[model samples]
Target: MAILIGTRDGVYRTATVPVEDAEQVLDSGDVPRVQTFPELDGVFAATKTGLYRSTDEGQTWKNLNVPQEEVYSVVASPDSERLYAGTHPAHLYVSIDDGDTWAELEGFQELPSRDEWHTPRHRNEAHVRSLGVHPEMSDRVIAGVEVGGVHVSDDQGETWTERRDGVHDDVHHVLVLGADEYVASCGDGLYRTRDAGQSWTSLDTDLDHRYFREAFELDGRLYAAAARSSPGTWSGEGGADAILVESTDSGETIETVSYPGGPAEVILAWTAVEGDVLAGTNDGRLISRDEDGTWVDAGMIPAGIRSLEVC
Candidate 1:
């Protein structure tokens, strides 16, 4: 087994599973997202430059032909041969030949809010920050567009319905916990829905800062991280005043989780393997908690990490 870390510089791999063993395997440039497809026996890196694939773990990689210049995220459909890529300017693409070639999902751009989808940084455009696919319902796919709100498609990518009621529009990530349950981490706060996006309830309304990015579920417990504000205004050696939050009862209640070294950085990536949970910070710090709940430094990456996955 190996842990794959996608960083601002490149992709790193470590079969040792411990952070200390991680080493750069592919220098494809600014890997914003990395994912593993066990059914295909390979891994993929959605880089700032292009999309790459590796079959022999991470020892080798090949660039795939994608219409977009920047692939921000890659996800595998339940059907092994089908794959999807979310790109800059917030466009979605589908690949049926395992990334060999991609076709633009034109229907995505026809949403009613397309004209209003603009990022704070670029102002002229936005990005597909995150995507979630139902485990049992392969036809359903939900995409979280930065500053664009959430869009749900029940017939694969053929059609879409935009839904932003009750939740913040600046969605960062969407976690599909079940067929009807979803948890969203956004620039405003965390939101949960049990009616398949028909309605939503904000969970972290009382938080001082609500720039949440990612979330994970392990052993019936939910974990997430938040920054005092957006990264655009973050400063000081401590980075954003980021904090970790946990929920044991499916997000009905949440409690702050303090790290052993104190909260000094922003956590952008999270993953769990064999019941062990790990988190990576935006300041090149990697750490994990012991069984007794003591946080320990794992190791360091060459640059800030954007995504993490186990293969």
Candidate 2:
């Protein structure tokens, strides 16, 4: 097995943890996500430059040439008939020919809330930070925008409905749990919607850490990490002052867990390998849970890891 670490610099592939002999597979800048679809041939990397795919594991890559330069997220349709690419400036594109060509999903720009999606921190522009689809809902598409909000498409990106009314607008990622359920990690708070975004429940209402980047689930348990504030306050003496929380009964209740880099390095990405949870930190640390349910340091990469994929 190979672990593909998507870092701020590029994507690195290593066969073993502790990452002693990691290789830079793709030089694309600032990979925000690395994903794989069962219908697709290989791994896909969403980078600052473009969307790329690697057929032979992570050794070499070919740019998919998404129309937008800064591809933030990529996912294949449930039937593998269409490929979606979300990019900076908060635009959506689709490819019907297995990424050979692309076309902008213009309906996304028609959203009434599009004008208010900009954030000054991100150069007054937002990016589609996350895209999700469940196999059961083949025609549904869920998009989480960094400075915008969560939006839903019922006809596979042909039209969109604004589902950001109750949820925080600064969504970092959205984990699609089921056809009608999702957990959104946002800058203000973490939210859960059971009715396909008709309404939302704040999962972090009672927590001190409001800023969340992502959430993961393994063995019927949900794991999430958050910082006291945003990234700007992470460089303080206490670092990010982050905390890792686990919820066995979904997000109704959570308990704090101590890890190798507590209150300093926040876990930003997660992926499962051999039934064990592997997490990547904002400080470039890789930790994994052992049989004893303890997280141990696996190793570190050159740059902070934004995402991870196992192949």
Candidate 3:
């Protein structure tokens, strides 16, 4: 297996941990997400320039040519019959013929709160930073928009319903745990909704750190990380002041854990390879848990990692 690391500069591929050599596979700038779907043929990278696909384990890439230059997120339909791409300015597009062509999901534009989705940090525009679908709900699509809110579509992408009322607006990623359950990591807090976004519960109300980027689940345990503040405040001597937490009961409770880059570097990406849970940090460190349950630094990439994938 090869580890694909999506960084600020590009995507890098390596064969083993403590990486002796890492090759830059795709030069797509500012990769926000690198993902692989079981039903899909290759890995997909969503970058600021465009969306790209690599079939040979990141050896080569072909631009999917999403209409918007800044493709923030991409996901395949549960049955792999359709592909969805979310872009900056917070728009949604769908492609049925692989990546050859795409059409806008105009329903997303009709949201009642579409005009209020802009944030000054993103030049008064937001992006669909995350997309999710469950195997049992093939016609459903969940979108997490940064500076906006989470929205759900029942008939693929043809129509959407706003589910952002109680959740934080600066959404980053949404993990679909089941047909009706999801965990959303946001710029302000982490949230969970077991009733398909009908209502939400703030899982981070007891924690001091509120800024979250992503959440992962492995072996029935949910893992998440958070910073004391947003990225702009991460440059101080204290660094990110981040903490990693794990929940075995599906976010009902959590316990803090220490890592190699703790309190300084925040883990932004996660993937499992060969039964090992590996995480990439915003400071360019690749760390993994060993058989003894100890977190160790695996290697270092030149640039901060935005996403990770194993192929």
lDDT of each: 0.83, 0.93, 0.94
TM-score of each: 0.95, 0.98, 0.99
Best-to-worst order by lDDT is: 3, 2, 1
lDDT, candidate 1, 14-129, per-residue tens: 86545666789988778778888655668888887888888887788898868887888777777776788898888999988877788999999999999999965865788887
Greater lDDT among 2 and 3 belongs to 3
What's the lDDT of the predicted structure labeled candidate 1?
0.83
RMSD, each candidate, Å?
1.5, 0.9, 0.8
Candidate 3 to truth, TM? 0.99
Model 1 CA deviation exceeding 4 Å by range: none
- Output the number of the lDDT-best candidate: 3
- 204-258 in candidate 2: lDDT tens per residue? 8789999999999989999999999998998967999999999999899989889
Candidate 2 residue 83 Cα shift, in angstroms, is: 0.4
Tell me how far candidate 3 lies from the true structure as C-alpha RMSD in angstroms. 0.8
| TM-score of candidate 2 versus the correct structure, residues matched by position | 0.98
- Lowest lDDT block of 10, candidate 1: 257-266
